[model samples]
Target: MNILGLIVEYNPFHNGHLYHLTKSRQTTNATHTVAIMSGNFLQRGEPALFDKYTRAEIAIKNGVDLVIELPTMFACQSAEFFAHGAITTLNSLNCIDSICFGSEEGNVDILYTISKILVNEPDEFKASLRKYLDEGMLYPTARSLALFDYINKFNLLDISKEKLLSILNSSNNILGLEYMKCLLKLKSNIKPFTISRVSASYNSENIDSNICSATAIRKSLKDYNNLSLIKNVVPSPTYDILENKLINNFEPMFDDKYFDLIKSIVIRENNLLDKYFDVNEGIENKIYQNVFTSSTLNDLQLSVKSKRYTLTKIKRTLNNILLGITKEDMNIVKDITSIPYVRILAFNDKGREIIKAIKNNSDINIINKFSKTSFSMNDKVFKTLIDYDIKTSNMYNLVYYKNNQHLLKGPMDYYISPFYVKNMCFKK
Candidate 1:
């Protein structure tokens, strides 16, 4: 019963994901696989192309046995928090053998070394990091430079500064480092494995091959409004699900979809924007100032983006505001040692077995149904986390089903059940 865990945001399952899934299982020689995936919103603070259930179903159809929702509070956050939520959730399962991730630098040893330095945070590294921050460098930029500085100054490893910078600069490498960092912090038994990312880069915008980035796929869909344009890049099941959504006129959701709503909220909460998570250091003022002049979400984000605030951070802040997630809410959950519950999104026959394994081996709560009675209402932290998941799902559904207003009668999360696939056969 070797179970492999993966942290993912399979916004739309594609060929690259298929390769990683197959290779990861082969590398770990695992009997089953579980994925902790982002819900309605993604880390980049954009709405998913399709809803969570649809994406989860595609994951099952492709290869993964079970898909658990990475709670909204963590899904739409920075790399550290996102990795913390995902790594902690997998650890809580208490049955995972190893966790696998895809990265440009496929060497686990190098990633592990970087993670150790980050987790330990030596005095010299801290001093250098602070120096960079004080110099007005963006946090990510500062951190990367600081890492290079610390390693170069101490001659920690035999690696060159150029090689180290290259590793830190790659998005997947950075994320993989975060995963290892969390694993070390928890002292979890789950071993980490990495596979080299093939073909397109993480943010590549053009479809050059069958394994192009999800960004390229989404860009094609957004630009052409045609599913066939991405038919070659994604697995057949993914294409089918996407085509179905297109046929139903439930066009893929994007950040721009919420522009009007965001604008309205910014206006209504102008003075109150400081209450939202990530809306600190007078960023609320920039948002309020930009909302009136910006016609689209991208425009507003660009307007608000500065040396201190990256585009992704700005977007996350706006999303936090839209979702009504407060800094206080983040503060409450910040110290939570483990995820309060594991919410199943979709699963197959093997998934059921995994669930049973979790129940027998772990005390973590398993949420298959979204009813109020399933969780402890008395637990404020649990309530806060679960409420955000429910709120984000309902919000996504409201926008997704905008054309079919009749479907918005009640909260969709309560009515939706974790999708079940009878057969566990992986589709090639």
Candidate 2:
């Protein structure tokens, strides 16, 4: 009954993901695996290449037994919040034995060490962090410098500054660190494991190898408009499903698709743009000022970008505006210790058993079929979270199925059932 948990976006299931999945299961010898996946929007502040349901189906088909949607509120957020939501969801399951992630630095011990320091934030570290922040460096860059300064001054680990910086600067490693930090923050008992990422880096656009990054795969699709170009990098099911969708005229979404909508919102809500989450420190002014001249999402982001705010951060803010996720909404759930519900996206036969186990072992609600009256309407936190999830799904559907009006039914979440894969066979 050992269950392994994975946190993933799986924008398009690829060979790298397949390898990580196989190795993680082998390493843990788990009987069941569950993944907490991002929905339509991803942490990188972009809509997924394919929607969540398609991605979840591909995940189950590939190997994972079950896939649960990470709430939209957390899906399009920073690493800390994203990890917090994911780890908390898995923790709520109450049956997970271990959680595995792939990282540039494969050593869990090293990542754990860094996570502890970050979670504790000692006096010296905090002082160093403040100093770097005061210097107007990006948060990630400042944190990296502060971490190195604190670690070097105290002679914490026998690692060079260059090596530590390399570890801190990597995308996967940053996520891995946040995962560990969240695990510690929750005092969860699930063991953590990490496997070294092979070949291409996280943001690498080179597709020379079979195990290239998801970025590379997406780049190939964007450049050539052909799935066959990435045939070598992704699994068979990924290729088949994506190809089928394309053949049926299902256009994959990119960030730019919502540029006009975002610009309009920025203009209409110019005075009160600060109400949205992460639209702080007068960044709203920059966004509003640029909206009139910015032609694309990229142009707006670049116009709003500064040393203090990264492109990704600006994109996340823009998405928050589009989703109408207000800071007040975040405040209402600030003290929410656990996820209100576990929403299943896709599952296999083995996943049914896991669901039963969850029902027996945990008290959290499991949402297999969403309806307006399924949960308590009196609960403000619950309402807020569920409303955002439904709203984001509708918005994603609006853009995704705009060309095909027939598919744009009202509130897709209420009618959609968790995708089921009968007689599932694990891919080798």
Candidate 3:
């Protein structure tokens, strides 16, 4: 089945995503589309606007045939680690033929060249990069300068301002390149595909006429009640479902129930703050400083904001705060490359068949109920994840004020229940 794979958060399944899914299939002969998704939390470290099951359902409705989670440990961290986790998951799947992603610059050779430079790491390259950073340039600016300098000297890496601007201007494209770097490192069977993004900006805060950014959409959803903009832009099925969900007294709930827990972890145990994944360079101190003075998540972020600390970095920082992810934990995460197993959230007939096929001839454990598993490592991790799920749902159901559901409402129940499944009408 020439399977195609995508690593996505789908936060709310916007138009740009729909385009990417359609283009992914057009670029591959893959019979099935598989996505390794982020769970409740996302990479930049913020709570997903919608939960994982909802996001996965949206992906399935839009195009994906099967959805497996990119575990919370990796899903909510820095790009390099996130890429390592994602690409490793793709490699472990053991069947994906190609991995498709959206990039601002669609030049495969150029991206590959840049990927090689990042990996091979010539001695002088690090020196030059260090020198640039010492001069107070942000990491992105320093990295870009280093690449441009190398390209201009050899006239090979393609340093044209237009070309550089094409990819470096957006954070998403930066992460996309990291994915390429990680893929090359793994040297897996999955071929790479990059589709140039069209008609949408990643962080634009305004809803464009027809092509709106997810950031803008998220802000609008939080700030306004009229979703005319969303109604006009999101795919019909998504639009209908989202509308029903919100209109039926369902307030848009975010994953913030453990806000105090994060604060407590950050402030109570100074050393524990050092445990979060990617907590480095005195960031634990930053959390210590912020947690003491802040009362809300927004305030905590504001207290910690600085030039070297990008918002995305802050997001990940907060994530580490909550997860207690430490640098040592990262070391533990790095040694494990292959995905432990494929964690299914929801599926239809095609998805069912795929599961059946895997069961008939698979080697790895296929966990239908991560809640029930006793696979030592998975048992512990899955327990914490589902706990978070039930907590978030319980909290969200309250923010809208319909009922006060218990935080740990499900566990022998629908705590991690696959939200919904839409039967696809793929051409026979």
TM-score of each: 0.95, 0.94, 0.85
Q: Which 10-residue window in model 2 sums to the lowest lDDT?
A: 368-377
Estimate every model's Cα lDDT from 0 to 1. Answer: 0.90, 0.88, 0.71
Candidate 3: worst 10 consecutive residues by lDDT?
404-413
Stretches of candidate 2 exceeding 4 Å from the true structure: 123-156, 372-375
**Model 2 Cα displacement at 113 (Å)?**
0.9
**Which residue runs of candidate 1 sit more than 4 Å off their true CA positions?**
127-156, 372-376
Position 278, candidate 3: lDDT = 60
Model 2 lDDT per residue over 330-401, tens place: 888654668878889999999998999999989988888787346555878778888888888888888888
Collision pairs in model 2: none
- Backbone clash pairs in model 2 (N, Cα, C under 3 Å; residues 3+ apart or in different chains), count: 0
User: What TM-score does model 3 achieve against the real structure?
Assistant: 0.85
426: Cα error in model 2, Å: 2.3
Could you tell which candidate, 2 or 3, scores higher by TM-score? 2
lDDT of 3 at 136: 96
